[model samples]
Target chain A: MDRFEYAEARLSSGESFLIREKGVNLYDGNEKTSFEGGEVVLTSHRLLWARPGDIPRGLTCLSLPLRYVVFVEEETGSTSFGFSRSKKIVLHLSQALPGKIPGPVNRSSHHYMKLSFKEGLNSNFVQIINETIQSKKWENFSPAATPSQASDVKLRAGIVGIERGIQEKQKAADESISRAFQDLSKLMGMAKDMVNLSKNISQKIRERQGDITEDETVRFKSYLLSLGIDDPVTRTDFRSENKYYIELARQLADILEEPITDVGGMMALTDVYCRVNRARGLELLSPEDLIQACHMLEKLNLPLRLRQFDSGVKVLQLHSHSDVNVVKNTALALEDQGSLTAEELAQMLGISVLLAKERLMTTEKYGKACRDESIEGLRFYPNQFLQRED
Target chain B: MAEVEWPWQYSFPPFFTIQVHNETRTKQIAAWRSLILDYHKITKHCILDTREAQRTALFNNTAIDRKLPLEGIVTILEDLARTGNAQPLDKQKHRWQIYWHTLEEWADLVYSWVQRCGMMNTVCTLYEITDGDNSADEEFHGLDTEIMVKILQTLEVSKKAELFDDNQGVKFF
Candidate 1:
């Protein structure tokens, strides 16, 4: 069957094509009236027409179920356009059907559609439409069963029961698969909650124990302590790797908060990673994962942030870290020592020499310290801020 | 007055690192400009060799254990040149003449030195104004010979003195 793009006809599932007649003129009234030119379509389940040319009317597109077709009729030279002859396909709807008309087409309405085909088109359309209507009627017929037919009905009934059983099993399997996906997400959320719970537990434990000896609550408490945390939860709780990393990042941030301040508010990222991993005990994180965790801290809006010097040295620092404070501290240290190298600064600040170098350079740039370059490397002394009495 | 002290930031290690951000770089460049000009003035030095400068205490901070690398020093000097505070002499930009005092300031100093020594309008050898016996009490005394010539050249440009290229002498107006 030829399909028209303008036709809004929907073929029901399993409905097959029958006939498509173009240039069929439709006239609801008698002959001598103008007609609308369009294509007429017929399918196993529906009959539809779409006006090819622009037509000024209430309904330019028509669709009705095949079941509503009452009969097909042929009229001689009686079309509204005074065509030589035309075939009228009359549809008697048993119930109201939705069409291009504004409201539902009335029930029991007789729709007279005339198709004027030249030569052999009318005959073919009439024959096909009649056969379709008859087949549809026969499909709904319930014949009185003879003895042989009764046995065939019982076999068909048994086959249908087995098909239904299979369908039920498939539906159950689909439901379980969907449920499993939902369960997985829920478990992920629970893992995150567990991290929080563990931290809370550790906090409570520390609060309650004035000075509990290492012998009591050794496994759980020691695990918490190993993570450099007083939280009740440890790294082993989360099943998913990503969730575990996120928890580690949070714990690392918390653990470093105090140490960073004590170490002059910043420390090399490698040093931080090593200390954090050591605190986490056997569950050591790779460098990439540690870097990712630090990045996650920024996204998580934690108080700690990562900074990379133009020299490509990466460090983790508190958001409140100020270069001024590091300069001040360096000046204080230099007050007594007069001048010290990176090694001495690292020792005084209790930070890595690399970190000390970074801070000292910043302090020097601030002009609070002056440097003395020698074969032994560089050392700084309090410049403008601290006066050295000879 | 006490010696001009460096602000605390000069000892910062990040200060040695090249600043990538524009705002910080601008501030760093300014800080470098002042430091270079001030140090050169105090030391009465003119040319700054990049390699030698990096090895000096001016670029190295021992207290913080940091030294501005050669490349970083070059960047700072280039910034100083851009601001007209220093002039790069070599095509490769390895050597720089730091303009601690502008040509006008040098002219003023030399012209005043001539007046103070009662040598105004006198044709004096370029070497005499720098190393001559009478030049001792003058501020331009013992100045770098090339710098003193350049200062006399400035005085010539302003029509305050005439240069006798044949004898390498200058006649002050």
Candidate 2:
């Protein structure tokens, strides 16, 4: 657009990065431009668009001053196919100012530009951009002219005015909280925004105070809750069972990969069920459906697999955690200790006694070790039977 | 009898339980068999009562407060019987005749002793062969009479000796 200018990617002293969206296409009015699938970054004073790797390398990029924008509105349209839809944010602009640096285009015919989101528009980005624009902290270019300082100037007139400001802010927070919880549908509609808001709050607090809480369990719980799946695969979404399970399996593998790695590459099926359901939130998956999806993981050549123990306890484990590796490791441990009980192995390996017992049993099953059962509990030793001479 | 020196496995608590694993159980049974034979050879005890074996030093490890249960004792005894180291005396298997040496082995020992003492072609009573001073230093000196008769009968089958008059006497020829 004519309003755009070519500038260095670095932010000015008083400006701060607000939000960024990838896979955005810059549209000049109704016509498309060569700037397709680039990253759009919003700052306190400007919106910058750069090719994927340009900004990181400090290359020249297109920057539009926020002062030139009159208003913004969302535009949704059905493509010609009628099956797929596209979303865009249209920014209306005023007349171009004088003395602007030349950009990708020297002149443009339109007074508006559109950012077509290749991925669906993230509502949180729109909300943040609106707030940044309304704050008008750009009006004063001084480095000390923060929104908090500006608000302090207004409320510092007297003690009563400061008290009234604090009361108004608290009342606004209370109103939003009550409004969000007024109905299930309303809460559901705002769940994504609320989660993003909470995450931002926690991030800021952690940056200032090191951590949000001292309790490890609560911290872990919050961490788990934050790993939410944006779009969970539902059975009703697909016509075929095979397709549904395949998609679900793919999604599950993606979500569980990090967690499984964190907890030693193996997790009980029951535990996995809980974690997946927790991440799914209102989209609760049945145990049967989860097992069905897991069965497809291996067929799909995923890195995860389902294994059942001799005692009928099922678990999900990384393919790297094969039985051969477990048995070999157990054999090595048995040789080192001469003999070991499940409890002792559990202590040594820092795993649950049940999993340790399972490992020992697996070794025994593979003929890598033998067990001694007694009142003290089952113990395993490196198999000397086959190797010993009569 | 001097105190029998037990093997290290005797002190292991899990040695009391009959292992569930097949390979482990086989090894465990072999250990038990050797222990039983060695104990009998040292203490010169010939019989094993299944009900009372649990209380004995052979089956019970008092130091560890562990004892071979009846089922485990039976399993080991059955294994020993299968290997010709022991024989059940009753249909219920509650009573067992433990032979530190097989009947054929015992026959060989007795025949060698008879030849060494120049008792060949000479008749000797079964009691004298077991309790007489001539065999005092022999490993089979306190052999049970029933087992002695069985050993002599084994010799008779080989024509090295003969049992006569209700197995009370044996002639070596």
Candidate 3:
């Protein structure tokens, strides 16, 4: 009755078919022209020949069983289905998965079958297609449970399908990434061991053993980084000019911010150098860079500073009174806003206990700040000095 | 001697110490020496020298009764000798003139007092100022001989007055 059913009964596994279709056709190489009953049919399980044909409205499942084809030719235009009969599975790229519409492909032999790609196909391109397929729920089949096993790892593809020559390059790229990750994994493992090692070193130091090595401090610092200990030092590549100085100042502010009030708001320059360098990803900073940064911060007049007290203890002191912005903010925060404990403020600022303490101490010394004590630790109140006694 | 509180001058610490700092020391010593002259003349007092004064009761830190140490007193005087308010009467004696009021100031005060008492046109002996009934009668009371002579010498030089030896004693006219 129709042009399709006439060829359907006559079609067999050996029969050739013609599909006049124009679009991207995934190929795995082998292609051949076959003559049957005065019809020109191209048999290409591997190669896809795009010819002018009806537009593909939906996906068609064209699966040749695993017993059919012989040698597969993995050429550029190959359709990924060269050795159809091989135990190897053929991945199809047709209309997106989960589209309900049937395939638009028709053989010149007039035989047609709704086409479908292999189940559980998960190439990145297939994913876009499958997401559409699953979203549409195209074919009626039991939903497969778990599809992606490697969602955690993500790396960008180096090259799109340039040709067969470049396809091996993609393979090379994958191998390189795997190698890099293996190296990274080894480093991460060593860092983990050091985390445990540093604890022992701390114990040994307490026991008054021979002093830890000069490098051990750096090693201990490395161990701390591994343990997720965030130090406040930041280092930049040494720059030749003044903007470098500005950058150093900005970075120094961020780094010295928490350490300012650590030792009663004062510390020796040497002690700060050791501690700051230790915390700062173990980066070596020249004294010149540090001094330059300090001078810049002095210029900025930040609440924080490099100060030498009368006792000759050089330390970073955060001046709460000097922090006009912080005082203004805390004033607002404590206005109708209630008093906050150190922990509470740390939580609010998403900072560590050290930073919270420094900020609070600075605020208190500014004299507009006071304290509230409870079962909880000390918290600062707004300068009650601002208000007239009722 | 009984300690006295001053109306305008108070004992501040650096008032005694030799300020090692240049500009500030000069200013500090000046102030202390001036304060010393004023305080001493008003109290009409004497201070022990530094080395010996250390043993005397001073600067007790008693939470009351402010006092100055002998070293502090010496330093204050040294500052004065350096400046010219008072001299080391004898460096060995460590004695000093307490010029709370300068000679000019004292001359003016004495002249005013004598004129008030209507003694201006009259001659008076140095002894009259210390011992005589009328002289001992007022606040312009005691006059040490040396200081009296110095004052008269100062006055005579200016031709404002004259000094003479009389049967009564050395007199100022």
Highest-TM-score candidate:
2
Ordered list by lDDT, greatest first: 2, 1, 3
Candidate 3 residue-wise lDDT at A316: 61
Cα lDDT tens digits, model 3, B1-173, are 44644322133322223333344444544555655555565566544345544343332223323345455577666666554455567757466665555566667666666667777657777777556777665544675566666666777777656777643343334
Error of 1 at A52 (Å): 82
How would you encode candidate 2's per-residue C-alpha lDDT over A337-390 as one tens digit per residue?
Answer: 989998998898777777888998888887777766667667776766534555
Local distance difference test scores for all models: 0.67, 0.82, 0.47
> Candidate 1 docking category?
incorrect
For model 3, the superposed segments whose C-alpha errors exceed 4 Å read: A1-248, A261-268, A298-303, A307-314, A319-390, B1-43, B46-85, B90-93, B112-124, B164-173
Model 3, range A239-284, lDDT digits (tens) per residue? 4656676666777666666666543344446766676566554345
Give the DockQ (2 decimals) of all models: 0.03, 0.18, 0.01
**lDDT tens digits, residues A199-290, model 1?**
78877767777566556646667665655444423447878777876877788788889988787678888789788776654345789878
> Which 10 successive residues of model 1 chain A have the least lDDT summed?
A96-105
Clashing pairs in 2: none
lDDT of 2 by residue, B116-142 (tens): 999999889999999999999998887
Instruction: State each candidate's chain A TM-score.
Output: 0.38, 0.43, 0.25
Is candidate 1 or 2 superior in TM-score?
A: 2
